[model samples]
Target: MYDFLIIGQGVAGSLLAWELAKAGKSVFVIDKGNPYSTSNVASGIVNPITGKRFVKSWLMDEIQPFSLKCYREIEHDLNVNFLSELSVYHVLNSVQEINDWSAKAATFHYEKYLSTSEIHYLDKEKVRNPNGCFEINGALKISASNFLSAIKNWLEAKYCYSEEVFEEAALNESRDFVEYKNVRAEKAIFATGYDEFFLKKHSNVKFSPVKGEGLVVEISDFFSENIVQGNVMISPTMAKGIYYVGSTYEWNFRDELPTESRKSELIERLKDTINCNFKVLEHVAGIRPASADRRPILGFFPNSRIGIFNGMGTKGFSLSPYFAKHFCDSLVAGKALLPEVDLKRFF
Candidate 1:
């Protein structure tokens, strides 16, 4: 019997297993092994500031450093390089935005994350930086595809990972433990990302899962190590001259499979964002398990051994590491999770 049975191997589940293992708990992680999952195809841009108003992300001050440290530790253990410090250039639309950015950057709290010196026009031959742009410090990029694959390989080495869909019908739960296919564990946690059917059926938790579409593009004239945030996110991939782009977040979507309209929309945005021509390399989509409250949900359903860790959404990259440790602490030491993220918020 394992100490824990983890369903899913996205960033959430993988990190949960990693943290639990660190706390001396044995884990068996099961995954459907879909490479096109949000965690794998995501641009993985851990931006400190976001949104139309350019407000700071939730708890970015604490999450950023902690996540960087955690990813570094993971790299050391796995002998892989997947995390890197990168500047994010937030494109300015007009002179008014430039002034607003300058004011925000001048503030003492925002100063640490936003840079005032780098506000300048990009090469006109490459990106369409008409009104120039300002740089954001403390931004990071996670080599998501490689990172997830490495973690899976590491888990497999310990004989703790399986590439298969979790079957709920085969699960058996007791007062203090759960058994799935004859494998028993003290608790079973669902870190299933956007596939949060368990939480929906069992609890009063409200999910506002958003469908996202993305594109892989090849811009021959564009070359930058930094992330460009404008109409569309132009993030560099591992391959030269190729980038991860688009990622239109639709609150309403027909299905997870990409639509032709979104594909054309992203291409149009790409053309408007950059001056150089780009060839569409690929189109992809994934549903992010965001909650209505926009907070992560983590806890056991009342009087049950089944627990859930879901609703990380687009910010999963920056949000998962510290919260994984938080969950581990709560489970191993009986520490309490913050109310905002706890399932108590719902029921």
Candidate 2:
């Protein structure tokens, strides 16, 4: 019998499995192999400062360091280069914005992350930055696709991974363990991203699914070492001259398919950000399992063997590692989860 049976091999499940294995727990991971799953299509940008207001991300102090440590350790273990440390430059359109950033930079908390020097324009021939920009250090552009693929290979070699859809009907729960398709585990945790169909039976977690679209484009004569965020964000990829540009957040969407409208919108925004010529290489879309409260959904069902760890949303890259460690400790050492992230609030 395995110590844990985890459903879904997205970011959440993959990280949780790694943590559990480190704790000397036997784990079995089931992945449906959905190509369009959020993790598969995620740009994997971990920004300490986010949104238009330039507010620091939640738990940035703790999450940023822990996430970097986790990814670096995994990179060493897997012998893969999936994590790229990059600086994020946010456009300062007006004098007031620049002054606001300057004021914030003087503060002890924001000093380290915010750049004190002003950058008028990244590339005068490419990007249009009128009033200059402020920098956020310790940003990361993680290649989630490559990382997951590496994890899958490792798990397969250990005979702990399967690529199959999980059916609730196949799950058998006993007093001490849960069994699925002849595989028994002491407990089961669902980290199934936006596929929360089974959540209805376990808890009253409500998900506000947000469909996000992004584009891969080839830009000519555009060279940058840092991520540029103006009207849109342009992040460097592994391929030369190719950048990942996106993304549009839409709450009302019929399906997860990429829309021509969003593509056009993104291109227009890209054009507004850059003056260089570009060609669209690909357009992708996925649904984010954002919670109603905009925090992660974690913890177990009352008096049951089932548990959940989902709803990292757009901040998945920044949030997953820290919480995965937290949840793992809670599971293995009887430690209590943080009250803010505990699902009891929703209950």
Candidate 3:
């Protein structure tokens, strides 16, 4: 019998399992291996400066350090390098936006990490972004696939993984433990991506899934180690001269397949922003299990043998480690959860 049975091996489950095992708890995970699992296709850019107004990320000081520490520890454990400290250059479009950024810079001392420095020597042939845009300091690129695989492999080594779709019929809950198939655990944690809709029986948990589309492009020029952010973001790939460019967040769509409309929109934006040409290497889409409030939802079910750790939204890379460790602590130690992100908000 395991101490925990985790459904879905996406970022949420993977990181939570890692935290639980680190704390010496037995954990089991089940995944159906969806390639477009939000974690797999995510650009995994942990940006501290976010949104149209460029406000600081939620709890940047606390979450950033904790997540960096976790990723570094896992890197050593897995013998893989997946995290990179990269600056994000946020392009300023208008005088008003520029002023807003400058005001935040002064008010928050954003100059410490953000700046208006000009980037020199981009491969002028492949990319289309205009030159000399203002830059921000806080961005980290993570190889989401590599990091997820590392944790998955670790779970496999412990003989605690099932590569099958989780069926409701397989679950059995008692006052204390929940059982699925032969695996029994004190509690079950669901991190099932957009399928969180399946948990609506609880009534309090609400998931506002957003469909996001991305493109993997091969560009012979305009390569940089720093991440570029404007309307969308461009993260460098492991292979030379390739980049993952994307992401259009559409709240009205439920389809996870890439659409021609989104493709055209993204292509047009990229061309207008960069002023260059590149070949599209791939098109991918996933529905992020974003919550209505835009913060993660973590809490236990009332009068039930279960807990949940999900609703990471697009900032999964920034939010997962902090919440995973927090959830593990709460599970094992009966700790108090932060009220802002706790499911108590919905309650």
State every prediction's TM-score relative to the real structure.
0.97, 0.97, 0.94
Give lDDT: candidate 2, residue 7.
Answer: 93
lDDT per residue for candidate 1 within 1-347, as digits (tens), equals: 89899998999998999999999999999999999998887778789988867788999999999999999999999999888798888889877777778778878889888856566778877788878888888888888888999999999999988888888899899887899886889999999987656755754788888989999989976798988888898988878899899679899877788899999999998888888878888999988889889998888888888889888988888899989999999999999999999988888
Prediction 2 global C-alpha lDDT? 0.88
Alpha-carbon shift of residue 269 in model 1 (angstroms): 0.6
List per-prediction Cα lDDT, in the order shown. Answer: 0.87, 0.88, 0.81
User: Which is the winner by lDDT between candidate 1 and candidate 3?
Assistant: 1
Q: How far in Å is the alpha carbon of 219 misplaced in model 1?
A: 0.8
Say which prediction, candidate 1 or candidate 3, comes out ahead on TM-score: 1
Which scores higher on TM-score, 2 or 3?
Answer: 2
Residues 64-143, candidate 3, lDDT per residue (tens digit)?
A: 77888899999998898889888876666677777777677666456656654344334344444344456677577898
lDDT, candidate 2, 114-151, per-residue tens: 85655545766778887767888989998878888988
Off by over 4 Å in 1: none
